[model samples]
Target: MKKIFLVAIAVFTLIACDKKEVDADANIHITGDVKGLSQGKLYLQKIQDSALVILDSIIVNGDSKFESHIKLDSPEMLYLFLDRGQTNSIDNSLPFFAEPGNIKIETTLKHFFADAKISGSKNHDLWKKFDSINSKFRDQNLALMEKRLKNELKPNATTTDSIEKAYKSLLTRKYRYTAHFAATNGNKEIAPYLALSEIADINTTYLDTIQKSLTPEVAKSKYGKMLNEHIKERKTLEVQK
Candidate 1:
């Protein structure tokens, strides 16, 4: 009878251990390797009330691989900050969309953000797609500004005015593209995030359209709440004008 009781206790302990692990898995688990990095500090951070907050951190002593875990109420944009213990600070932070799951990031110390390979978050994938196209718009804008500067040296009013008009047109197109992208992806958290981050200064009509199209769940997210508040403030300021 004592042997049988011992066997039952062992089964119970195993069940309890398994249950505990399953519960832990429900939280955000971030694991990654920073190549060419022998020692540094990695911080998992998020923006709260317009301020950056660290959720978790790990010290990398000898191993390049690091892991961090935190609980998130909803899917939001998160940043990974690397402190390389150097005086010259550049390319030290990497941004990735984080949700309640396992996310992996792999990158080298040389090109932190540019060389990052992130996976396990659908929201991050959508952001990547949006950024790819947005980069082209930015490049075109830069080229137009450069041409305008060159024309300024000759002091041609007509050429300067023409370039200014083209630049304004390009800016409007970029804003419109951002609005449409947010409106169409209302079901995801990225929609409100783009609205608040990329096109907050856009026309009130476009902002209202994006806000209304957001899903109920996303509309209550951190970015969605901020977007709503921003629109209200903008309208209030316009009314006073």
Candidate 2:
């Protein structure tokens, strides 16, 4: 009888361990170290109904390392906001693509977003690649703006016209590139996200093409649904106009 009781206790313990492991697997486990941060609050946030909502948060008392977890239904864009008590700066928030499973973020207190090193999320990796190229377009636009300002100081109609034309051409190229990127990456959630965020004001025909190109799985994602709704709203306003 004593032997049988011991065997039953061992089996129960094994079952309990398995259950805990399964639960952990279902959650998004985030761990990171904020170098130079002695005390602060870190928040895991997502956009819901056009508002930033906090999913989880942790307060670091003296240590720079922190961990947070939250259940995710599907991969989407999320932000890690750091609030260093009594220190105000515009570089505190870091945005990352979040999916279920483990993600690690390492950054310093001084340049939170610029110094962030994110790992373990494939969606974030994809966004990083897209953003790298998109940034080039932005840089070109800024240079063109500088040229326009310099020309405006002298007020030459010919030079102004040439710069204006270049600006229009650059804008068209940027829009087309964004559309192509979204359509080519239709299988990823980032596809619809980029469309809605970057080029929603472009031709509705382009938006229509992107919406149709989304895979069945991606079409049901959070950003995918928002893209669909946004397209519909744009069409409705067009008709009213």
Candidate 3:
């Protein structure tokens, strides 16, 4: 009876140990090359309709090699940014599934993102879903901007000033508010995407309201033209790219 009891206890201990151990999730390494650029930063952000979460970031080493590890619970949108680098490949969204172990990511770019290869997951469906959603959102944003530019409406000086001020606020706004949510929930990947998504609306609504409040002369002055021209240039850049 004693020997049988000891065997039972030993088997229970082994089971408990197995349950407690967690294998390292797949490895994730991101590689990219930028023409005529060096010493920039790369960030990975998680996306949501309501907010963005910053999952991780790293300095682009001289060799342009960067690696990170992510353990995903479910399918999520990954936002990549070259971050102030002159490289045309500044932003992209990809679907990522993190299982147990390392995955490899390699990308090559001449002007924009040219090639990307990912290995170590069989779930290609998740990637397709993410890509579709990302494209839809981008189209929606461009459409809104195009509509505003085409309207050709004019606003007074004071109102336009207020609007521009508000637009600037979008960039200056702190990330802490959105990021706090991720930290509180124990999934910190959504902060950056959440923060960036607000920039467009902040500019649009503020300009729409303030322009209606402007005086005619203020609208026609060099200052007003400068502001309008700046906005036009931004639009041009977006479309050209």
- lDDT (tens digit, per residue) of candidate 1 on 1-241: 9999999999999978754232363588888999988987888888987799998777787999987777888898999999978547689999999977899999998899899999999999999999999999999989998998799788898888889899989989999999999999999999999998898898899999999999999999888888899999999999999
State each model's CA lDDT, in order: 0.89, 0.88, 0.47
All candidates: CA RMSD (Å): 6.4, 6.7, 19.0
What are the models' TM-scores? Answer: 0.85, 0.84, 0.36
Model 1 TM-score (2 dp): 0.85
Candidate 3 has an lDDT of 0.47
lDDT string for model 3 (68-171, tens) is 66555543346665576554444444445333345555664333344556665433333344345546555655654554454437645665565456544533
For model 3 the TM-score comes to 0.36
What local lDDT does model 3 show for residue 193? 23
Tens digit of lDDT per residue, candidate 2, span 17-112?
Answer: 744232454578889999998987999899988899998777887999988767878888999999866776889889999887899999999888
lDDT (Cα) of model 1: 0.89
Name the 10 consecutive residues with the lowest summed lDDT in model 2: 18-27
Name the regions of candidate 3 deviating beyond 4 angstroms. Answer: 1-37, 86-100, 125-241
